[model samples]
Target: MPPIALFIALLLLATPLAQGETDSSRSQPVVSVDFENGVLSPDWKSEGSGNATLVPEGFGAKSLLVTLPDQGSRFVHIPLSAESVRGRRIALSAHVRGENVTRPREPWNGVKVMLKTVAPGGTDYQGLMDLYGTFNWKSCGLITTIPADVTEATLMLGIQDASGKAWFDDVSLLVLGKLRSRPASPPALLPPEKLDRRTDLPRLRGVMYGPQGREEDIRKLAEWGANLIRWQFYWYDGTFPEKRLDLALYDQWLEATMAEVDRMLPLCEQLGIRVLIDLHTPPGATESRQSAIFQKAEYQKKFLEVWEKLARHYKDKPAIWGYDLLNEPAEGSVAPGLLDWHSLADLTAHRVREIDPHRAIIVEPGPYGGWGNLPFFEPIAVPGIVYSIHMYDPLAFTHQGVLDGYPVGVEYPGMIRGVLWNKEKLREILAPVREFQKDYNVPIFVGEFSAIRWAPGDSAACYLRDCIEIFEEYGWDWAYHAFREWHGWNVEVGSVKDDTSPAPVPTTREKELRAGLSKNQSARAVNP
Candidate 1:
């Protein structure tokens, strides 16, 4: 190890973890660059079919610039030995500039400054920031937690799958202490199966929501003909950025969330709306990635502990129809055979079943990259379980104006990238999920799906209409991505990105949704 790396390793070893410790707020500079010398140093190397050079950039200074000539990505990275950053929490940030960048097929493929760690076995982990189109110098950063077992670490900056010019300067990585200490595993609970007595699932339709004094949303949903509500019950406190996953705060918020649930149950009961207790954020689930819970056995235990507590507490709550095991399970660099998302979800569902067998257990497959997750995931063999998927397919079209650099004018039923996306396309996207239901003879639920409220040319409504039409055809329980949650997903809002407020009048997005949901006008959850 180099002198600085050796010092960091020694300092990390000398530091002791306090009780209930987490990632620290304190950070130290690890490496940085301004490229003022007008040369791309030997420490940095370029990859892919793109031009990379240190150029006179900004005012009298220099920045590393990458020009992608065609449709591909190129990166300039500083490779380092694992000792330099392994097991440490780090932030990678750079002043980045992009010009006339076209949209890429994937969300992560754009103007990028990311930290990537690779285990020798070939498992890769990254915290990425993607930008596109014309943008001046913007400071963007990503925080990543490195595993102790990593063999190589890299800080990468570039433009990907886009034809444009991007410049990077003032790039730096901050060592934010070390990874969280392994908490003691909670005792394991026995997996249970008594599905023969499971309550029959209703043909439900609703939307996912993160409720905050939005009890009135229930009435609005019922009027819209919704019989279900997937409450994104975030148990971890989010009031403080640094304390998002703090253990004490997690427990405190968990209790507070249950209290809120208690207050809403009577209203749901009266409205005949069943609540799906969706644990949106579990312990160790961070803003950077959803894979943290799968990294450590202790973290998985903490996750299961949350479910076990809820299972025992709400086992008798008739207003709650089920427990949505997790929000999105994107396991990163999962150690082979030790733990994968499928096994963990199966284990969690069965554990929840042990306490509340009557209400069905719902689980979503981890998005394992490439051809997406749903089509590849096999049905979990746990009895009394319903398979789920959250659809925002062809994100370039659906999420057009919501996130930065997302290209606009891509409408539904039109060619996107290279393929036509209509109702049949939606069917093709969900084909694997359909096969899962058919092959297993099991129920399916659309835990969440939606386009941005401001998608172009009534695209949001058109896409939603087609999705709902197909979902109903297949008898899948469906829920829009949100209801009174984020203004971006609020269908009632008009198609104006800047106007995040609720629509003064019913908009096209709401019209289509209400048309689909109107089927449930008299629908009621048979809360067993």
Candidate 2:
């Protein structure tokens, strides 16, 4: 996965509500906390060192000063009850100044101001802006429209990174009663004739990680005549609000995660692109804690709850193509006496059906959900569902310099580190997926497939073309591994040189790839 900070940044970006609307109930400030009285305000609670204190002279009169130590960081937060700001547009403003806020890498010492909303069942949403450099008192604020279900709102200000001194003054929050909608109902959705059938067209192509505010990236997919996008969201990031095992925190995480999807759905609908939401569990849960979904019964049930919530949230959105239950279920890593992919998928599929029987539900079979296991897979019997498989076969060529165990100079076509590889071998490797599609009489989706850009000359395009040919021949819908997040999986960047070039090239490599992928007769069918 790409760095966690990237995902956080993506999630934090939101389209601020316009300030044109006004409401009678929003005349007064709903919440205010400034240490003007020369004492730590009782309304705010400090976390970590809790170094917040009232300084005599500051931006205004007395300001809240947080002393930053050489190691770790500190924060102060005030939790607002739901009744106070529910169904409102909140505007939080503060005067903040930072000094000597330095760090070795990202997430360095900076003063961050955030406005967060929490819903009953899960995390609704939050947005934050950061100030890093030493400067005079500057006014910073954030405006957001709280979701309907929000039960709590939080205002947080803190210093991060190695060392920094931060001062906060005149912190205030005002709630503007809910923005009025135009009172138009959404279009009615008709049920499909058959169970477990594709509602959209047959040919599907695109990439993943369509980050918030990156509609142009998704538009790029549409410009290439692709029909679908398979974006992913993590079950939990490293932050306390998300990573904690508490059900409350998990609820918050779900709300916040789905809010991101809801924010992007409109753009997708406008661009004629469908979305498949992949619940990607982070490495902290899967690797460090050894608490993957299939490993424990409790975790499995919680995973089901996540799907239930997501299905309920997106049941009516036409742009939602499907719900990919889990990114890649690792059957090999499951503990003894735990649920297998077949049983677990069955459970989640049933639960999702309770809320939405028509929205497509996607399931992937084991051995890391790769193509090798698809032939042995038994389809889960559920309506509006499809079988998903990830293809990275002939790992030597596809992964090349990306995989740690693989040696450098592992090229495609012939002799991957002197192992003699070619398109025929690649075709043989993908035969199972093709054969499986023919045997099952069910829809197959290549959820992920890519060749690292380090492959020799046009090898990346060659590999992608071969994979697309098989997908087209099998009438399968597919998405490349990624769209704009990481450059390594980006074949659109044209040719990249890892051996000679220190850094990968920008996304200039899409012309040849676009030609190869768009060559499908289906492209004309969809584009024309």
Candidate 3:
């Protein structure tokens, strides 16, 4: 045995294992990235297609060469263990060079080394060193303390969305002595009154998914007694290069969209409707590249810049409720190790507050924004901000006959294709969000929830009313899924003369919704 290995073994023998502790430290050092045998390590795995090969001409005469095709992202990674370096500071380093690499100026897509670790119960954490665009030989590394509960770690390097060549050599992982004793996890920064603001503001109810030029529809929503509108507007419609975006076209789209918003806000103010300008993009849309936006440094900057511009424009508009950051992000959607929904929300919220301090911002937990994911979100600890969630529980029921695979005849308050679904089930489904509300004490927003028009009207009404009742029970602001997007989502419309266009008039469903929402408001008023 090497002297270092013998010494580590002796040290381990001297210390007794505590209860529930594993004998994890190995006699052999975990060398994850040595290309000494002219091959990538078998312990490493690949996520996408790329020409990954061992080259003799590396930093020390051997390296891993990755040639990414003009396609989606490619990743090479190796997994490690917390037991290998528990309670110690570890460093991961690699020498790298790139050629013919290209990507959009924003929405970072590039080669990077990511250290992802998971706590015992599966809380994902990450640290990173990224290299983007074309670059000469350079060293990238990350230093992080291995938390005691961490059970797993992964080191990754890859290029995303760009046709390029990259060289990684002299890769390493090393443990430096025991870190300072500390809490097993970062404590919640929950100070009483992060800053005091109005907590009893009248709960605003409305709908999501609308573009500008719906002035008449806005008026109709006001008539229905709704006061909030989560406006889903598209800032970029045209496709750009996957690896490189055309900023000039983005500028035009921004200018045109902002101008339309300028015109629409006044109409909303006149109609007594507050607006939450929703920066929405359907998943996989060019602008809502949930996969790439957080990783690219330029993209991160641009996202903040867009929010800042909106904040500056609506700084004084009390009717403009807040900025709903991204529509619904997903798990594993962000660039590895760079940023996650929580990090993005914290950054964007702080930036927007700096620009417009009083407006209440709404942030949602990702993995498609369902209530179950709420527990994963860390509190932003900012006052005057609300946590948002979308509800489509028993989607088998609410989405019956509309969404694909749901087919018809899936009923609520009864069996949904052999599975019983009722209001009780709904409450159980929402338990996580309820727990989050209790834990965080932040305001809640049911930003989107509804049954499709194809659903039985009476049953759908029962479901919708139940949702509103639950929201009110918790004092949460609520909104239907959409206003002027799809005829099926409109309670007032059984069908549309033009399904592609908005239904301009109220249908029977609208009357029921208006009545239900008004009842909710009345109950709140009586108790408020």
Candidate 4:
């Protein structure tokens, strides 16, 4: 016979007691027999012809004695049906005694008992118990889990070498009661009815400096219908590690920045203004390099640790609207090659869920705020996650004459025609978002969208008006790129170097533009 077939036959012979049946009913009787009895048949020959017997000593009254062979050991098997031990956790116990037999070359000798379950056309699960040392008689025990899919189970008792001996008795296998399954979790509750219609429209808002500038400026924003404020948190001081990355500097900045946020929270709360805490880094690394940081295990650990701390700090503060994971994560521009935007967004959103389970998370897409690879807004496993797309398309027209030299020049007259009012353009531009909203059942928020001041023929105002219109039509939320800053040409200022500060007052042209845009609030009127 082949070795595999012999192994299978041995396993069957070892476990003779059938489950859910009496011992007398079995073809092979479970009896108290001696070594000279008819238990040793020609087919049931011992491997090494060693002395073995059914004795009446080791296990209180009666037991089976097994003596090891010199060359090697062989297993004893008894046939068992497949229907016996399926889907159960079985317990096995036996009284075993190891005899002391000194060998000329080997160190020790003993017997091993194995319990195995084999499923039809599947792998076998095996459990073993080894009897070692020089014990006259000791009770040994083992517990094994029978897989839910198992069809048959086998038990084997064997000894290795010719000199060593072992005794076994009072073996028992028992079936355990079935376990109850756990209940499923309840579904997430929807946002309250009071907050259902609480939509924010896009408006020119000032990005104030920290706590001191927060109150007065935020109140001004509320009056101007600028429902949101774009805020920043730095990762380091101006001079640290020669402007290189430093762990200490990063931690210190996080501590100080969060402190400032705490101070601004109540102020924003009182003013009824929402805050978008922008997590930004200097433009140094490329998207690929930055994305690598997220892929690293160590970096992910640190990132989550920081967010957990922040979430605990602002657990129930409604003034804080969302967390902008990163600003303009692009490839090859900062870190070289594109950052894995999709993976990074998914991981960041997951981490945020672990911390503040319920907070709107704002995520931006690719290089320099381009929406080329807008992420599909799947039902965020966590509630209140928003897809943020920054629209600065036709950059040449929007960033004209800026010192950094945006690609599109101010002379390029880009007009968004077809929409009745500039605001109506909001509906057309957000056509994708409308589809996404219906598909995923999640709200859309334009985190940042605007045109440059130098764009020709009042294009900036026209774009702004249309963008706001779109936001209101869908009852979506949005934030203007800036309130009054030289970062882009979107500000209602005449010149880049002009003193367009909040208190300095607006120019005549700025006044006329604001009035015309404000009156063209057709989108808001209809949606409201």
TM-score of each: 0.66, 0.58, 0.61, 0.50
State each candidate's clash count. 1, 11, 4, 32
lDDT of 2 by residue, 367-457 (tens): 3576655544555677767888888866767766664345555555766533456667766767766655545556778898888876667
The TM-score, computed over Cα atoms with residue i paired to residue i, of candidate 1 is 0.66
The best candidate in terms of lDDT = 1
Off by over 4 Å in 3: 1-200, 236-244, 282-289, 331-333, 401-404, 495-508, 519-528
lDDT of the structure predicted as candidate 4: 0.48
Candidate lDDT values, in order: 0.69, 0.62, 0.62, 0.48
Evaluate candidate 3 by giving its C-alpha RMSD to the native, one decimal.
Answer: 10.5
Could you give candidate 1's per-residue lDDT for residues 1-528 as a string of tens digits?
101110111123214334333223245566766666433346666678778876776522666678887988887777766786766655566677888888777657777777777663234436443367787875555544455578777778788778999887777776653332222553332221211135644568888876464666788888888888888876434455466547787777778888887888898888878888988777766432434565456667888899999999988988888888887765533423335566678788888878877887888766422224544344566777877777887777777775544667778878775567889988876776666565556677888888987667788889999999998877788888888767888887778878877779999989988888877763433333
Give model 4's clash tally: 32
Per residue, candidate 4 scores C-alpha lDDT tens digits across 323-366 of 77666653211112222344456666787767776666776644
Candidate 1 residue-wise lDDT at 213 = 42
Best by TM-score: 1
lDDT of 1: 0.69
Q: Residue 142's C-alpha lDDT in candidate 1? A: 54
* Backbone steric clashes in candidate 1, count: 1
In candidate 2, position 128 carries an lDDT of 32
